[model samples]
Target: MVARVGLLLRALPLLLWGRLDAQPAERGGQELRKEAEAFLEKYGYLNEQVPKAPTSTRFSDAIRAFQWASHLPVSGVLDRATLRQMTRPRCGVTDTNSYAAWAERISDLFARHRNKMRRKKRFAKQGNKWYKQHLSYRLVNWPERLPEPAVRGAVRAAFQLWSNVSALEFWEAPATGPADIRLTFFQGDHNDGLGNAFDGPGGALAHAFLPRRGEAHFDKDERWSLSRRRGRNLFVVLAHEIGHTLGLTHSPAPRALMAPYYKRLGRDALLSWDDVLAVQSLYGKPLGGSVAVQLPGKLFTDFEAWDSHSPQGRRPETQGPKYCHSSFDAITVGSHFWEVAADGNVSEPRPLQERWVGLPPNIEAAAVSLEDGDFYFFKGGRCWRFRGPKAVWGLPQLCRAGGLPRHPDAALFFSPLRRLILFKGARYYVLARGGLQVEPYYPRSLQDWGGIPEEVSGALPRPDGSIIFFRDDRYWRLDQAKLGATTSGRWATELPWMGCWHANSGSALF
Candidate 1:
């Protein structure tokens, strides 16, 4: 029965082809050869690179691979439909280090071979014809006119942001032509059937797509404002959406454009050096420099990636610091194992044990005091101190730090130079020998860079004596000298969102 079924399937193609009158075989063969040669020349491949005759074994294998690549059925025979595809021009740039490049090459090669088989049989249909081209998209239902020049200028500025990237090429076609990119604006009432609508507050202000043929859609329904009017900034939100379109997801740097919040920007405010550097690393280089820093892991397992939406499963685990007293090597929390440095080389990473203690649940923040060798973990709106190796000592509650109104995702940095401990969350605090107190440090422009209304996930002291803070997807640096002299300190440029907590140096070997 299986043999009979296979025979019938094989004969089905012949039955269909039998209906078409055979034109002079010579005429059909000549046309096929000419078209195939043209495609090879246009795509910069030698004629010999693609098999000319259907019966050739090399031709059969090439066509099979091409068919498989394009997601078509793998039939080794080179039909007329496939032949036309073999003739079309191919435009693909190759990069050895790029994962995207490798994926695209595999797709292109498969499409080319599949086209050869289709063209041989003259089965190429209009929509089905293999066009060795990237996917194209275009904007639809764009506004005919803007309410004000400010809005128009802002839109142009957003487009220019991605266009200026050295690694990205923005192509604009005639108004009626197809485009590889599309931009659209929808009123708050418009819904994409996916429940993604811009309600009055906290709904999506805008969303962007990935590189190939992606569209950026903004919800025009919300009342757009310039600055932090009523605590919302349209320019800030638009800038962030633009960053998404440029292939940057949300980062933990608070001041970064990719931060997941609405921010306001002035007309003069453009991409900072850090912003340019980050985007350039992904797209290529501006004037040309090294690529952005690559972390060891494919995904960050820090606190930020924790999904509150997940039903209580096993909590993600982390190991405590391991010490090498003999080598004077100490591994701090949040440090990953990296290559060995010359004199300060820190060897392999020792994993921490995961176990439950009779302590409070929902611990949101933690800090280690190197001076006293005590680790403090915060949960339930209070701080608890634990001592001994691996924090296995009896835990005792410390004086409650009362500034935080809510449980905060926090970071603690011990500044050895200033002999002070800095606790950062929605706001920055200093813990000295006396007690915990809110530092008088604020951004120069109190209205623009005042208290953080959200929890901070990370903090570190820079070599330059400035404090660096990391929030959702942005990073900000506070200069100590500037903070002392004026209300606001110098803000270092934003860094990429690496994880909830990051460190410049320090590691431990097992």
Candidate 2:
């Protein structure tokens, strides 16, 4: 009877009409037409000297460009969204260069800087690299009719801002062609006349892209001045914007050229060390050097060893333990359990049953010693150390106590391979011998692989002494062997388990 009912259900004709509902039809086509008309009315019938021949082709192309720029469905039709965007205020294309305009520009600058700050915070918290490599930019130069001397001066000043950085070398082969960097200057009416002056508020005051390829444009509309007041400081603003174009995001440091607001350049405040380092990071170091060698293959793997105590009736006392350990140069006082060797014969594996000191209940993470008998444990974002056997010292007691940022679900463990204390939460932090500093690891590009996950679970040191980490279900490894280079070797290793879940016993049977 059950089989017969199932057969009848499968054979029954589904009522497709039940799911269909009457809804308002889309107006994308009509919106596109309106946008075309608007563009023609503005730029089409401007001057009587120019013959007005408004063709569908022209309007169609404008609509297409608008659709593409706004990232809406590209039907070459100007829909409501496209028309709205066309009428909206243009960024970096304001009319006047007044104090109000400068204020607006300042506001925009701050907005961009704030966005970068949020991004950095996210990176620190999430351990996800959300930076993009390519940025598209159009050029706005001085009007061709501008006096040759004025054009030459503005161009020279603009170029000088970037060229002044000793570490950055500009590619100058193609005079005015497709180079990694492109430059253009606009003068007086030509800049402001098209209702697209570069000097207006929220308009182009000059913007740059990352190192690979970028373009810079100056507003010829503004009264470009060399002095501190009266008009916009050409060299100062140009230098700042160019810094952005060169991949240096705005810095919180006030004296930095990459700082949010516009400040007159001081004699000593040319190119800062931060600026030089940032630019060099993108473009190869000025002094030629060999690229660092990356590790040969993937370093991290996420696996779940079979649990000995799985079933209720037949619980096993001991589970097969995985092991990892590291060697350090020196061991300090207040350090616990040295020469930490765990499982297998890499070199040394020592069980911490005798040397292991039980920490407080909240202490989820702990690290031991290689040279001295001091054990460090982290709880509630703070560090505490157990000296010898009885004495206890909070990290704060030891000058400027620093540990990983506090999180409710924080877990701490000692990485025997790296000789560092590892903190796991939204992001991973490593506290090495050189004090509690944030780890600096190159983030892998996620564009090829959808997006990065929030929590990274499994972490293990490979046989080759490189570190391996797992995000989501995937594994990644950092080859310390190839420390100084741009690209590192990556591999996708297989693991039977779904997550990187394990506990390092830190015990070896040697």
Lowest summed lDDT across 10 adjacent residues in model 2 is found at: 295-304
The model with the greatest lDDT is: 1
What TM-score against the true fold does each predicted structure earn? 0.29, 0.27
RMSD vs true structure, all candidates = 24.6, 25.0
Candidate 2 local Cα displacement, residue 230, angstroms: 4.2
Q: How far is candidate 1 from the true structure (C-alpha RMSD, Å)?
A: 24.6
Tens-digit lDDT track for model 1 on 79-172? 6446534433111111111222224333555687422232211111112221322233344543333233434334444555554544444444
Cα shift from native, residue 228, model 2 (Å)? 4.1
| Candidate 2 residue spans exceeding 4 A from truth | 1-140, 143-166, 171-176, 185-204, 211-213, 228-230, 288-510
- Residue 135, candidate 2: how far off, in angstroms? 16
lDDT tens per residue, model 2, 1-510: 999998778766443222221111144556546645655344322221124546655565555544543445666554445555555422231111122222343455568752233222201122222134232233334444333343334344444444444334443334444454555665433433454444443334544443454555565455555433234555566666666555555443334455444444321335554444344444434334533221100111111111122242221223212221111101111223234234321223233333434443323344444445465554345555666654365333331245355421222233443445353433445555533554555122222222222333334444556544443223455445452222222212132121111234422211
How high is the lDDT of residue 84 in model 2?
53
